[model samples]
Target: MRLGWYSDLNKQEKRTYWACFGGFTLDSMDSTIYALMMPVLMTVLALSKSDAGLLGSVSLIGSAIGGWGAGMLADRYGRIKVMQATVLWVATFTCMAGFCNGFWSFLPVRFLQGIGYGGEAVVGAVLISEAIKPALRGRVAASVQSGYAVGYAISLTVMPVVFAFLPEDIAWRAFFAIGLLPALLIWFIRRLVPESEAFQQVSKQSRKIDLRVIFGGEHRRITLISTILASGIFGAAYIMITWLPTYMRTVLNLPIASTSGYLAVNIIGSLIGPFVYGLISDYISRGRAFMLFLICQTLVVSVYMFAPVNMTVVLALGLLLGGFQGGLASGLPLAFSELYPTQIRANGAGFCTSFGRGFGSIMPAAVGFASTEMSLPVAMGIFAVSSYLIAFIAAMCLPNATGVDLSDHPASVVNEPSPTEAALKKTPAVFR
Candidate 1:
């Protein structure tokens, strides 16, 4: 019954794959719930566009912190435990967000909620990357992100139904309450997922919480480049993802059917994109795949933003916009893991994706502030094209790391300090 990449995976790998797939699906759902509700929140809470954008930006910031912290914790404690904890944390905080009355009150809850959101994706991607074979890694890891589109569809499908049955205020709250349901998956994870064999093979005594490992030597160059790469990747995608719903409804004055058509098409494209991108990357090169997607995305976004708005234009280009951009969302986790050794794999990968969000976290607010002057499409075009251009350049800079063997990574890199670090350690702790 198994076909394609699924045919290649054994039972243990399949188990890990499904576990990560479920976690990521929920993570995507919780993240989209905020975006879906931004318009409702604005009407009920008297929030300005900037305020709504701030809420989006803050959660990304929280996710940034959570991701980096989780990676470090995963390296020290264990991936499964930290992943379980993060899922529980996100579910709890997200439900609490439903109770808040204003932006100020919602701020802390949303931010706390984001921490879990960010941690889960980074850890899940890292976990899957560690568990799967190099030959199947791109196809498998990238396919997992298709769950994002699935999550978006779930939110889109459920939101209207919830709103149809309940009062506006109650519907949003009920939707938020639904967030807690992901917590139920933690039981399955605990029972089914085992610690990564790679982690077990490595000596526990050698592990420590040193931050410098990811920032020094061979890691330093890749970390800096990958962070910028991730920033570009996330910045490009999230800028549109965060604000598109609001733009369609508020700026375009889109009738409900038209808006839904565009979003539905876009979502479908996003669902299909990761698989195609993964197949392309596996056969060609990861760097080439990114370069191709980023270039095409820039052109597609440019057209999507600048071209005159009509049902025809929107319908024709909507799929390309979502497919081109959304597919690239997988690039960071798929590509970045090969850049580091096992010990700091999560730490490095986590920081790149998380802090990439940290860097990317700037745009929603920027678009919100810009909405005061320019058209949303204009603002989106300017920033989105810019983001893609940055990503294209980063893609150019990245080493071709496709189908790299993960099992062969040596532990010597983590234990060894670079020349600069060696000199600094010998000096006094404070004065040096």
Candidate 2:
């Protein structure tokens, strides 16, 4: 029997959802593969913690530029085309990283890979947001974002096997090599996903790529607020997500196997978080949902970093922290998608998320720098809480746009449909 959000979608809509989901899953896998290898890279390459952190930051910087560029290109060209290009771009560079023997060689490769990684995120989110009906938008988009955890889980699960079977020098290289396989996902995307009807309709009617559209008049306030919100969330998220493994190993003094187990438990929570946020946002309001998550996540992360616990207790705490913080990961994309019109939606969403990543990208290097003076946990805790607080404040000022329609122009802010609204009778309940 038909039920919930999936029941409302047609076959092509379903395909679009899965294709974006798969793309995001692979994107997460390829982007984070470097983090998984950092410890090994440090040992074999004789590098320092700061050097490793700088490598991650460089990629995020590239992501920022690529995201903004691709978003603009997607508006001018098409979302699907940009998505295909980004996947191939990252896949090729990631494989080349595996072949590099030193810092100078790997730096350029990772930076290029970062560009594709950032582009994929913005374009894929735009594709899914444009394709889904308004009512199902939150749940569907959040579900796709949840694929980050799925991809993280896949990498975490495979790391041990790859490291164990292969020789030490080549094992880390193999992980990067495995990232190239996502290039094949482009085939499924090309075959199964169709162009967004909303995008196609709007593209035919609009020609200008006015970057100023997001910066002036009514959009000005939203642009600032949304960027701040993105900054806080991505800032806190990167600090914790990128460093948790190292934190466990260096601070808590856990072995590699134990660290992987802890991260795996955290991944399970990450998987559950987005769905929770989506359901709450759909039923309540997006602003309230963001506020709730930011507050809860702040507390969870603070405790996870500050509280002293046994290994079993730490695992339980990791799960809680992961669910809350991971859930927060979906808020910005969902919020950004609802804030702008179809004509410039990709550009607005892309700039906000990528800009935030650009701002937050500083955290890894900042944390690494601080680790030289203070405990890793303490340095992370300070930055994380600060970022979350910023997001909480921004969420308070954000407009409640849970049911906003993307297919319409700015003047017409349609409310959820009633039974008497003839056009919406066949639409989902949450939308109408």
Candidate 3:
């Protein structure tokens, strides 16, 4: 649990890390509940693969809107403010989703919740990305994402308890009602979390942070590539995660609650993966780190779906399955912040990642569509491996920014490491 990467952080940065880490963990927990409940929902609501896929896709589509709008608001108001609002927003809607009896009623609730989920992910990353020193940026910013695995592990542990005690139908509702717990984070944030200093500098200038800034001039390419990279990275993930529980239940011939052991291993691997990924990224470069994971994912997942292995072997493979998948997540959050300046930093990163969610959202449904023609495992494996391959190509195009200073100047989108280190040496020791 001890991380050398965090030792250098000041008190405010430490608080910021806890806030983002807590928020991202709960966000993963809340969002993951739907997937875990899929088997029951399908039976209760008379759903199909396509229906389940649509629900997953709908939340992500909502996230696309939420992430960008929250980013714009974060740019204007402040990161802490927007983050607080998002946490409250997600908690309210996630509880509401449990009340729905059918897909028609549940769809809109999921979308509204998606808005909060998407907003929390980007705003917190931006908050911490700006807080940490450049040398530790990739390691610190990306390691915060491991909170996703922590949240997922919580869900895996708690869901079996809910199912074991509650009535068959009501268990899912109790699972969702538990989601209301994340709202408690707001009090901690209001008391302890500080607004990003980078944002404070941007606010003092009173300049407008329009959406066009990211798409204009040299930034246009960065935005396009990051979006593509996000879609590929997250798309593959959504394909596997959105359908994983059901795949285990129906195809693997296990009960919904019974498969938790396998998933627990995967989640444990997920917890360990990002920390290792952060170290790799900080030392090697973000793009190279991504290339390594993406390639490994292609191989591991292929073996996961196709290898004629026994259950014991598959259980062990779950470790690698989760590790590579969890590791793939660090790139967008870290790179997006570095790809743009303070004026449009949140907006640009928001646009790329949010829209990446938008495009990636379809992959779950695509898996559903593909499943109609082939075995479900074949479909998921194809989509997963293909998505990573595409993302790997995008990684090749990424500009390295490992040591760049995150100045709030109108233009600090420079992606090279050395020039920014030299520039920082010439400036005041403190940002003021």
Candidate 4:
């Protein structure tokens, strides 16, 4: 197959990719500030560990709702509109979070921010998948998705510098207000991005949202397997990203600077992980690439959890864990896109991924609750091992997409209704 040159992408696809990437990167930056500032916030607000955990859980729940709703909206209104709306929503709320006077105010603001964050990922993934060529799609999507890690790295670098100069009370709020910067990207998106061609073709065929179809026949098996796989992977990811810094600080007894340094190293590994997996998935089978990463993740997470707490050992383990986990972001978009047809691609990916995200949200809180009773290392180890089991199940159940042409599948298999069936059945419910 002839690979299209980057220059060959019509202006619209290029614009869509960059806009989606920028939005997602900013979304990561906004969401990560809270994790980076968790310790400071806990002390400043005089909140308990459980309370801190609640804040994170509530945000995840909000994101779950946002992603679900945004997926449907993207299907109905077009990806560009949903993408623009979500970026504005998250940016405004994230800035508001910085100004909150207390827990009550912060909770609601963060919840709203979560909605924006959730919508960004779903919209971004769908936009990129639709715009890029099939052969290059995995790598391009992974590159766009890697913006999250880039944003995360920026937050880690900026936060300490800002805190060093300003008082904690003022500095933290300032960090959050920085989220507003992404809203500026909306102008670029408005100028450049086009409605996805795939989305446009599907929309002309059907405007209804029939979510129940996801559970009928062959799709039911794929849906269940995808949900379980996504839940386990995301659960592990959320726990790792949200609480690992605190774990480094409290459990390993590292200073703030040292913990940040370790996290920086870990994130570098994360930045590399996706690109590597994207390459492998392009040349090899997507399932094979995912399986390889899943095995590595299982091993890395176990070692990171149970290893003796020396600084060098911990840093090494953290790097490996970040790399393995990072590969999932690359694999998931390609895997899920291939699983369903173009019509319902956003909905299928959003529902399975966000729902899994919702289930995974429980892990961080569970880890926090377990920390009150058991050792942090033991609690983390349990979460790590559980993912291995989930990976095994996914490996067994997910279909191979090595030679599949997405366009050949009935759009309803993804999200579009068959023209013939339009006369016979009512539209499906949009599962937001």
Which candidate ranks first by lDDT, i.e. highest?
3
| Candidate 2 residue lDDT tens string, 101-130 | 888888888789989988999989888887
How accurate locally is residue 122 in candidate 4, as Cα lDDT from 0 to 100? 85
- The better candidate by lDDT, 2 or 4, is 2
lDDT of 4 by residue, 1-432 (tens): 535445656667678777877887788888998898888888888877787777887898888888878887787788888888898898899888888877888889888888888887887887787677777777777767778788889899888888899998899889988878878866566557667777776646575677775677546766677778778788878888878888888887888788889998888878878878877878766666777788888887887887666678877887787777888855775577666666667777777777877888888888888889988778877975786668656755566554344444434534344321321132122110
Name the better of 1 and 3 by lDDT. 3
In model 3, the runs with Cα more than 4 Å from the true position are: 1-3, 203-205, 408-432
Q: What is the C-alpha RMSD of each candidate to the true structure, in Å?
A: 5.6, 4.9, 4.6, 5.3
User: How does residue 222 of candidate 3 score in lDDT?
Assistant: 75
Give the higher-TM-score candidate: 1 or 2. Answer: 1
Candidate 2 TM-score, true structure as reference: 0.92
Worst 10 residues of 2 by lDDT: 411-420
Q: Write the per-residue lDDT of candidate 3 for residues 269-291, one digit (tens) a residue.
A: 88888888888988877777888
TM-scores for every candidate against the unseen true structure: 0.94, 0.92, 0.93, 0.90
Candidate 2 wrong stretches, greater than 4 Å: 1-3, 203-205, 410-432
* Candidate 1: regions farther than 4 A off: 255-258, 410-412, 415-432
